[model samples]
Target chain A: MTDLYESQRAMRAMRRAAIQRGVVAILDVGTSKVACLILRFDGTEHVLAGDGIGAMAGQTKFRVIGAATTRSRGVELGESCAIQETERAIRTAVQAAQKMANVRVDHVIACLSGGQPRSYGLAGTVLVDGDVVREHDVARALASCEVPDIGPGREVLHAQPVNFALDHRSGLIDPRGQIGQRLACDMHMLTADTAVLENLIYCLKRCDLELAGLASSAYVSGMSALVEDEQELGAACIDMGGGTTGLSIFIKKHMIYADAVRLGGDHVTQDISKGLQVSMSVAERIKTFHGGVVATGMDDRDLIEVGGETGDWEHDRRTVSRAELIGIMRPRVEEILEEVRARLDAAGFEYLPSQQIVLTGGASQIPGLDGLAPKILGQGVRIGRPLRVQGLPQATTGAAFASAVGLCLFAAHPQDEWWDFEMPIDHGAARSFKRAVRWFRDNW
Target chain B: MRPMKDPAPSRMAYRMNRLMLTPRFRLFLRYGLPVLLIVAGVSIWASDEARRDALAERVAELRRQVEERPEFMVRMMVVETGSPEIEAEVRDILPVDFPVSSFDLELDTLREAVEEIDAVASASVQIRGGGVLAVTVVERVPVAVWRRATGLVLVDAEGHRVQPLDARADRLDLPLILGAGAGAEVAEALEIIEAAAPVTERFRALRRMGERRWDVLLDRDQIIMLPEDDAVTAMKRVMALDHAQDLLARDIVAIDFRNPRRPVLRLSDAAMQENLTTRTRVYEAVVE
Candidate 1:
């Protein structure tokens, strides 16, 4: 546990040094596309470390100087399946972006969508040793939370404090300098498969780039897609990508739940290819240009030519009605939405103050999805695009680039994590367990 | 009948347990509070002027502590390639105190200051071992002495003023130039003086005429008018003629070489009257 804390602190220090040097790269390794964006920090102001609550603090400090994307290979379901192919693809994207920006970057902050994330909420309280609450008391309260056995192959990605309480008063954002007998804390922890993380680190090492930071794509996408009010209240951002559908729940401007379904837009494309007997590339083209979820009577008359390149004349050309194309796409999209709804239900998302569900990503571009989403995923459903960032090219300002833009925001103003604090280490193991139990008792 | 009691507390306990197990609540306290505290602290620090000033002062104090370490102290400064007077002038111009921290010294600014001195042509400053701030300067050498109305000023090859001389004999090795714009034409004058080395003992001064051409003055009230375009070659031709014909010893007042194709000589008044008498006597003899 201390090893993890130490490494996290070291990584934060490295990130600060990189930012001070005035350039950092943001890499988004997704299922369908791998994108690299080089950001140049003008170094006008020193970004205060550990300041996580302010959203617009570092907004104008950085600008995208270079952006490049290439078709992802050897990656399936948002995880790298072939090391060498993914390395080659990453090199191509990074080199192209560096050439465009005319700057070489050695530090990178990467985001990924796989690893089967699990969310856990833990609470703890500590009796105030002083008349007024202080930072150490808050740290003690956080440390008193019960550490669950997240299993051997999993690692914690994000552990953030979402709520606080002082004595009888609950939902206190900050209890410091306030008179309270006991201080309580509610923390949210997200863990992912360790193997996936190790693979990513190894790949970065092979590419000769330092891994300064890492974030869950689902969490960052919610950060970019959801409005400020939506995040403050409660909302869920479902990012429909090529091979994975990432889901993240945000409340009080913090991600409380994150999960990914192994099915995404590529499944729909495969359905089209099998249904119309067309090549995968041609199916993708048809899906992007003519696909829709909700069909109308007018769609029946619209015919799309499904061309083939086989030597046979009969197989070279074929035609399908737009309605039939919709028929092939609607079911798969519905399945993805259903899976997302199930995951949200499991997370008890409906109990939150707001239930706004935002659908964003490449697959969310299907026509009529906004009309059909609420029917399957319940009310208050909307299609979302990534928030606009300064200096982003016209091609990258779309729903598909949510994670990339969010990564930029995350890199500029990262939320404080567990390792950022100085944990108390004087207590013996047995006494610490007892203190944990007692703190839990007082909070309950 | 006993099972009809409200299960509200139990239900609340179950909900609390489930909430505690979720990722959101755990992350909120663990990561979010520090962020909030830091933001609050930073905003407070930034907004409060007095506190910000105090923080800046503390940072500056810490930086000074590091900079004033023994290894970084400049114990002495050494000046190279200058006379004692020039070295003293350089030291006065440089803005550094002895035993000062090297980081506090701006080397480029110091170099510029040293170059601003009248005698310094170029200066280079570097920090060498043994706590030495070594400054190497190349001082300009005076090539000619210009006799201006105010005083005699020493001028370098590029016609830059080096210093003022109390007397012309103080720098007898340098050639003397006269007139208002003579300092700007020092290079050409020096070249002409070198070409007239044979007659240099008889040469007195070279004056700039109308800021275009030169009038070479000799010891015996004789003047050589030189053309502007090929003044060096013309001076060389005059020197060759003087060497062959002892032109300075002849009864001539001026040698005009403004037009290289036509060289003219103006004889003295006595010499001209003697020539007229001799010509009249020859005409009378021819008539008889």
Candidate 2:
């Protein structure tokens, strides 16, 4: 835990240095595409209240100066499988973005969508040290939370204190300067496979970039896709990416639970390729152009040309009906949503006041998804695009770039995590020092 | 469907691209490099002594071509003055050749040289339009002719020497002040001459005595010695006395008013003998 704290703190310091330089690159190493956005932080100013413009969740502080995307080569399920190939893809995206922005960015904030992220809810309480609760009491209460055994080869990615309760009053976002006998906080910690993280860091290193920060794509996409009210009430953002469908549960504007399912749009593409006996690229084109979840009578009449260059005249000309294509994709997408529903059920998402589910990412663009999603994942499901940002190109303002856009917002204003707080002096090395002092007092 | 080939830049190309994107390096490539190349090329070309000398020679030749244009050439000289002799003297002293470029002329030094002439009070030298060098001179008017031991020289009222005179008859209208250092007191001598207007027919010259006082030399060997401090007043008193008593016609060879309180006269030799005989007869008459 201390080691995680030190490294996360170091990353925070690196992020500070990057923001001081005013330019940072946002790299979303998704399975479908490795997207890079060069963000130039121009500092923040308060907007006038009654002018129909709000704070915009701190997104106004930075502008997306350069954006580029390349076909993901060696990344599978958001983890780099082949180091050199992943480095080449990253180099391609970063070089393109740098050329567009005309600046060299050394610091990068990246997100991963794989690694089987697990969420843990931790609660701890401490007595107020003074008449009014101070920041020190909050840090003490946060430190008093017992760390759960996250198993070997798993690293803590984010540990945010979601809620604070002062005495009888619960759901207090900030407990400082409040009269309370006991200060309690519920913290949400998400951890992922350490090996996957190492691979991502190694790839970024190979591309000559310093890893300033790392975030889960599920949490980031939730930040970008879900509206303020959905986040404030309760919502689950299901990012239907290529190799994985990442889902994160947000309540009171905080991600309380996050999980990823391995079966995704790529599986559907593979299914189409197998069902129609076509190439993977052809299936991908067929999926993007004519893919649907609900098969109507018109869809049955629609036929998509899946051309091939096998040099055999009969083999080259093959066509599949849109109903058949929908037939191939619906099962996979249903399976993914069912898996997300199961995860959300296990997370007790239905118990929340508003159980809104937002489906986003590259695969979520399948037509008739909204009509098909509520059957498996329950009602209140909607297809969501990322929030519009300043200077973003029209081509990139899609569901697929949600994580990339969220990374921009993240770089502008990062939420405080457990590592962002000062560790209570009574823990770790400070305890040993206190022990030594006690021993000296006894001897004297 | 297009081929699924992954395209990426080579490592060296990527590094080079990033290097080119660096702000400092880009600025250097955009501005500094071109300026540096130009300066280096110029310096390298100028490194050879012969080439540098050729360049300098070219510049000098261009300047000479511009200077020697017909419009810039001073073809002749003109002197604006009241006296022709002074103009000739100015032309002689300057000694400038015609059809020379005005650029080659130093007008200020020429003006200083012209002002060095004795009769020229002030001078200005300029090259006028139509290829002419005009020299304007202000000539001094001689107020007195000083009879120095060397010769008589025309001197201005301020006692500045104008020029040498061959003889006194050359400027008879000007008064003569004769003696050592008399040129310096020409103004005072002229004042004394003005005061002795009543004895103008007898006035021959005003001679400086002992370099401090003046002696008015009249015709018929008569002289009036005037005091130094107010010699003009002494001359005026003498003029008044001569007007009332016809003092200049008396048989007195010299009158001394150097003391100013007493007027002393020295009689001529025959006049003294006649004065003694007259005095003896008057004494004999008085005794009988």
Candidate 3:
């Protein structure tokens, strides 16, 4: 745990250094594709002191200079399975982006969509050290939280203080400088499998990129796809990626719970391949062109050629109705949505004030998923796309790039984490030395 | 089925592409490498002393070819002088062969050399049309003739010697000045001669007395010694005395106006003797 903490701190410092360099690359190592977006910080000169922290947030300060996406290889469910192959894929995407941006980026902020993310809610309380609660008290309160046993091979990805309470008044955003007997903080800590993170790190290292920060793709997708009102009034974002369906719950602009089901668009493609007796690539094409849920009579009449290269004449000229393609794609998508619904129900997402569910990612582009999602995942289910960022190419402004775009925003202004605050014990020796001096002075 | 090739780059290719994209390396490849190559090539070619010397010799030969072109060649010299003697003197002093390149001519130094001639006051040298080296000289006008103990020489008003004279009578139109250092004050001598114009008929020459004052010698052996300060004014005073009193016509052989307040005149021998005899006769008659 301490090792991971130190590594996380190192990563945080690296992120600061990368931002100082004014150029950082956003790498989304998804299951189906690896997308690299090079962002150049244009400076915060136009961000008026307090104005930009509102609706626009920090997204105005950076512009996407280059973007490239390549078909992922040797990665399963967002975990790097084959080291060299994944490195090659990352190199291809990064090289293309570097070519486009005409700059060499040394630091990269990457997102992972798999690794079995688990969220833990922890509440810690500490007595106020002085008459008024100070920043150190908030740090002490956060540090006092009981770390749950996240298992032997999992590491904390994010530990954010979601709420602060001063004495009896709960729901305080910041408890510092408030007169209170006790300061309490509710922190949301997300931990993921350590092996998955190590694999991703190794791949990035092979590509000559420094891991400045690593985030769960589900959290970042929520940051990008969920509207401000939805995030503030409570909502759930389901990122139906190629290899995993990730869901994150947000309330008061803070992600309180995040989980991913190891099932996504790739599974649907697999299902189509199996049901229609076509190649995986061809099935993917058919799915993208004609795949949908909640099929109508018109889909039954429309036919798609699911051809093959086999020498057999009938096999080469095989065709399937659009309704048949939908019949093959809908069940898998429904199973992924049902799994996401189960994860949200277990997370108590229904208790939030708003039950807005936003579905995004490459898989969410299925034609009739929006019409079919509310039935399984409950009401307020809308297909969501990533927010428009400056200098983004027209071709990349689709639902598939939600996490990639969110990584850009996350790189700009990351939410405060537990490690951002200095540990109170860091100043222990100095404080003791001063105490010794004060004791001598009082006696003399 | 022919297997589909992997779209991913090989590790070597990827590393090479990244190395090429490094901004510093790219800039070096684009600009620094070419400059370095050219410099290295030239240095290697020039490393031998013989090669360096050959290159220098070739450059000099090229320069010589350009300089010796017909357009820049000066075929002959033209001296514009007031007299043929002066022109011949100038041509003899400058001993340059004909058909020399103008680039080989130092015009400023040649002009200085030409102006050093006694008869030449100022000169300018230039290469003009038809490949002619044109030397234009302004000849000094000899204002007076000065007779030195060594010889007679024509001197200008500013007292610069122009040429030698064979005899005093050879330039009678010019007033003759004599004595050491008289050439330096020819201007003052000319002014005094102008003041004594009324007695010009008797004026023989003006001699510098003590190299400070002037002594005017007239043809009848009359001599006027003038004061050093305002010698021209004293000459003018003597002229005024001659106009009013016919002073030059008298038997006075020398008039001393060195002290202008007191004029002293020395008469000739017969005039003095007749004056003494006349005085004696008048005394004897008075006794009877």
DockQ (CA atoms), all models? 0.01, 0.61, 0.58
Put down candidate 3 lDDT per residue, B73-128, tens digits, no spaces.
99999888779998998898886888899899999988888988998989999999
DockQ rank, highest first? 2, 3, 1
DockQ of 3: 0.58
- Model 2 lDDT per residue over B1-288, tens place: 576565788888998998998899989999999999999999999999999999999999999999999989999999999998998999999978888999999999999999999999999999899999999999999999998888889999889999999988988898888999898988888899999888788789999989999999999999999998899999899888898998889999999999899999899999999999999999999999
For residue B255, model 3's alpha carbon misses the true position, in angstroms, by: 5.3
RMSD of 3: 4.9
lDDT of 3 by residue, A245-342 (tens): 89999999999999999999999999998998888998888888878887889887888888887778988798888888888888888889888888
- Per-prediction TM-score to the true structure, in the order listed: 0.58, 0.83, 0.82
Better model by TM-score: candidate 1 vs candidate 3 = 3
Candidate 1 chain A: worst 10 consecutive residues by lDDT? A51-60
> Using TM-score as the measure, which candidate wins?
2
In DockQ terms, which candidate is top? 2
- Once fitted onto the true fold, the runs of candidate 1 whose alpha carbons sit more than 4 angstroms away are A43-60, A427-444, B1-288
Q: After superposition, how far is residue A332 of candidate 1 from its true place, in Å?
A: 0.5
> Top lDDT: which candidate number?
2
